[model samples]
Target: MRSRRDDVDDAAAVERALRLGLVGMGEATDERAERRLDRFIAAPDGAFVWTRDGDGAAYVGRITGPWRRDEDGAAVDLVNVRDCDWVTEPVDPGLIPAAVAQTFARGGRNFQQTHPGDVEAQTQTLWLRLAS
Candidate 1:
């Protein structure tokens, strides 16, 4: 469900909207959104996250700080954000794991955990390579 208060970037505003049923969401939808938000908030520091920009440039980063509402991010519709140490270069498409590539191809707004045991192993290997 699209937030009715999309223009309001603060977490408080978003919470208010959700709690007040102002976003035109059914109970189940609101619960799902809350769960997603809670997961994001609970993500530990140093966890890796992969994302793509509007132009489809892929990036990977390690979360460096807790989640917060950043008004500056409103322009990109990413008000709820965490500080991250993003890799300086865009991830080379060829190096992206099949699982991750598929995830990106599917395209969803919320963050999702990449799956399959092999994908985790592949990501660790890639992370080590990038570190060196």
Candidate 2:
């Protein structure tokens, strides 16, 4: 099994592939894209979302500040979106890439995040990164 670190890397690669695919398909162009990349790179925080193990109910949560490492040397993944007063909705995991692209195009910061469902191609979280 791959470590969580590897999983994160894989997710990032997949996201990059998706973005590039979008651009190749002409959905993304250079005309107004520089601002989007700049916006994403400048963000200090990112939104969080996740799904439960049994039922694939998707939920959106507030930004949990910046990325950090725990004392155990493990990277802190994300806050429990399930624990907060988050918004729940039904979403198809396959559609995440497009959503993320849309977010970036609108000058929102976000990156690919790993989830149990994503590994299984079931459901995944779309972390919408935004400037604090």
lDDT at residue 40 of model 1 (Cα atoms): 74
On residues 6-82, what C-alpha lDDT tens digit does candidate 1 reach at each position? 45333443333333222112111476777877777787887777765435666566677776765643443445666
Residue 88 Cα positional deviation in candidate 1, in Å, after optimal superposition: 0.9
Q: For each candidate, what TM-score against the reference?
A: 0.71, 0.25
What candidate 2 gets wrong by more than 4 Å, as runs, is 1-43, 46-54, 71-132
User: Which sections of candidate 1 miss by over 4 Å?
Assistant: 1-29
lDDT for model 2, on a 0 to 1 scale? 0.30
Top candidate when judged by lDDT against the true structure: 1
Which residue pairs clash in candidate 2?
Answer: 109-129
- Tell how far residue 92 is off in model 2, in angstroms: 12
Error of 2 at 128 (Å): 15
